[model samples]
Target chain A: MVEQSEQYLLTAYRETGNLQLLGRLYEPYMPLVYGLCFKYYKDEAKSEDAVMQIFESLVAKLRVHEVSNFKSWLYTLARNHCLMDLRTESRVSTVDIEEHLVESDRLLHQQYEEPITEERLALMESCLEELNEEQQRCIRLFYLEQKCYKDVAAITGYDLNKVKSYIQNGKRNLKICMERKQE
Target chain B: MNNNYLIIRIQRYLNGELSREEMYELEREALDDPLLQDAIDGYRLQQRVSHRQLSLLQQRLADRITQQTKERHAFYFGWQRLGVAATACVLMVLVLVLLWMRNHPDPQRGEKEVQVELAVPQAVGIQALPITGMAFDAEPAQGWKAFNAYLAEHMGNELPKGEVLLAFTIDEQGRPAAIRDTEGAVAELLAEAKRLLDNGPTWKGNTGKIKLIFR
Candidate 1:
């Protein structure tokens, strides 16, 4: 038999108020939630606590909020919860620059949908040139050469995080540049 | 892909175990999915997620769900269980009362039974014969009350229906001896009276005359 999807479990939990169904829906995402929490608190114990707390909040919040996409909604919830905790503790942690670089997947989805015509390809190539030197090089190594992020970081003599950030920023800039060219 | 596979792939990516193509594919996917991207970043910072800790958390979640179910069952059926217990108690008391009533008849009925016994002798009249009363001519060595009781007990219900006079003297052991029937009672009656006085309780040494009337 096909395993019940998270969507099915969510709907079942909502209708029946069965906590088991909700637990089933929430359990799979615990690792990701824990990781996300770690990004903020940077402590394993606090991150674990936040993962459980996020599930607890969802028990009530999911009832009130109409979630179109559970995964995105849950991520937003986890991030906001971590931020609120930090705010209460009167501590400051730097917000990730990658967060602002890619706000949504609309550009990526559009790019993937449109056929790679010569004009589109030419525009994307020009947009690639507009990125900073580091981003341009990382993006080309990762996308064009089909190199992994590790190989890209090794070749560029940059930190893994730095390489990932550069490529992410490069992809967003390239998409924005392509959109501007089209307009 | 399933959650486990995705997590394992992320772990492989972090551990540098994924091949170049696989790593590129995961990186490309993470670009479009911020959740996955942040998770990859979180896993990178943490180094790795302990399977043991995650399973422990899952166990805690399962326990919470089970605990809620137990509380609900107690809340919903608790009153029903109490009601059944109360009904059983009432039924048990009722049965005990019924059994008690069966074992003991009414007090008024017991009194009625005694009245019936009293009425039967009167209705016959033949069994109404009475042995009036007895008198002592002189006080014996033993008390007159005791002597009368001894005589009545020894006689049982076979008291002769006549008056008999007897004379006797107490011996050294306080026994009545040398008995004679002064009224010339029947030989059998005299012999019986003699035997009763001889075996009766000891009295003070004295001359004693006794009379008994039975009618």
Candidate 2:
């Protein structure tokens, strides 16, 4: 997965000049990236632009990131970009109503896609809700934002290693949460 | 990873908290560890469900940000390369606007700083003492200036009594009430001892006692 994830990052960085390859490389990861934007800004179009801006920023700063964990790295980048956009926009007006689309997009997208029939999903949502805000945030960044540990750190303003620990702890807790319900 | 270590690490991993090396280590271990694999599977399922819930939220926020970004950056995004002319025009407009606002009559001028005086006097205590008064230089009974002939002879003793206990009573502020048990010369030795002890540096003892033993 490391090798694959790295390959994807390298490809995206190198071939962003080509829209086709750029889309193909990023499309699979879009949900995670978009999820990050929506999480912070809670709007689709703004988050979508956030997604675009993240890609734009990624392309702009492609040469600088010595990515140890590519997925986590992207998540950090996406989360940071979304927050920056949120800050920039705050001085202008309130978070746009379109940003609220994030709530609706979840249901609409789920229904649009193959309905995730797994029974564990319900339990998982419940488990997630039970987590403290920071833990839940860390989890969403990891799975939904597809951010790497270091990236999560950059976005959350935590120490680099603490992000890793939070995700590691969050995962163990989520696993326990799912199993507890089964028992 | 040990079971305990892995449990902790796996939680962070599922939450996307681990670094590249940490993640690789876990992923490598999961290949052989069925328990870990199951854990990952459950977490993956959790991710799917969570992402579904988060998508709507992302959509609405993204739209607002896009509109705002466009507005803030509108000046820079013109379809021509006339950067210098555009910048000059904007700068002049800004200067003129500031000048206009400054020249306009403003209601918020000559506002005075409100002066307030609080004459709350704090009570301070002063204790008066005269030179040669009993407590003026009242110190420890040690190095007593033997005014009497008996104490003068015993002043420089060959065998010095070290830390002998003197039992006595004290009022609330540790002033001696009376000498509880005094024998021989010390029976009438109350005034000097009281003056000395009252103004003396205490070594070790509670002052609020009815009878305090001092050595």
In the order shown, the candidates' DockQ scores are 0.33, 0.02
Worst 10 residues of 1 chain A by lDDT: A100-109
Interface alpha-carbon RMSD, every candidate: 2.3, 16.0
> Which 10 residues in a row give candidate 2 chain A its minimum summed lDDT?
A102-111
Clashes of 2: 48
Candidate 1 local lDDT, B1-215, one digit each (tens): 57778889998888879888999999888877777777888888888867898888788788878888898989879988999999999999999999998899778899998888646533221111112224322345557666665665565355456656777777777777787777888665666667777888876646677775544
* Candidate 2, Cα interface RMSD: 16.0
**Predictions: Cα RMSD each:** 17.8, 30.4
* Chain B TM-score of every predicted model: 0.35, 0.21
lDDT of 2 at B151: 28
Give TM per candidate. Answer: 0.60, 0.26
For candidate 2, write residues B1-215 as lDDT tens digits: 13335445656776777887687567545433323433454344444224443445345444534555575477566534477678889999999999987888454442321111112111111111112322223222222222122222222223222222234444445344444333333432343334444454322222222111121
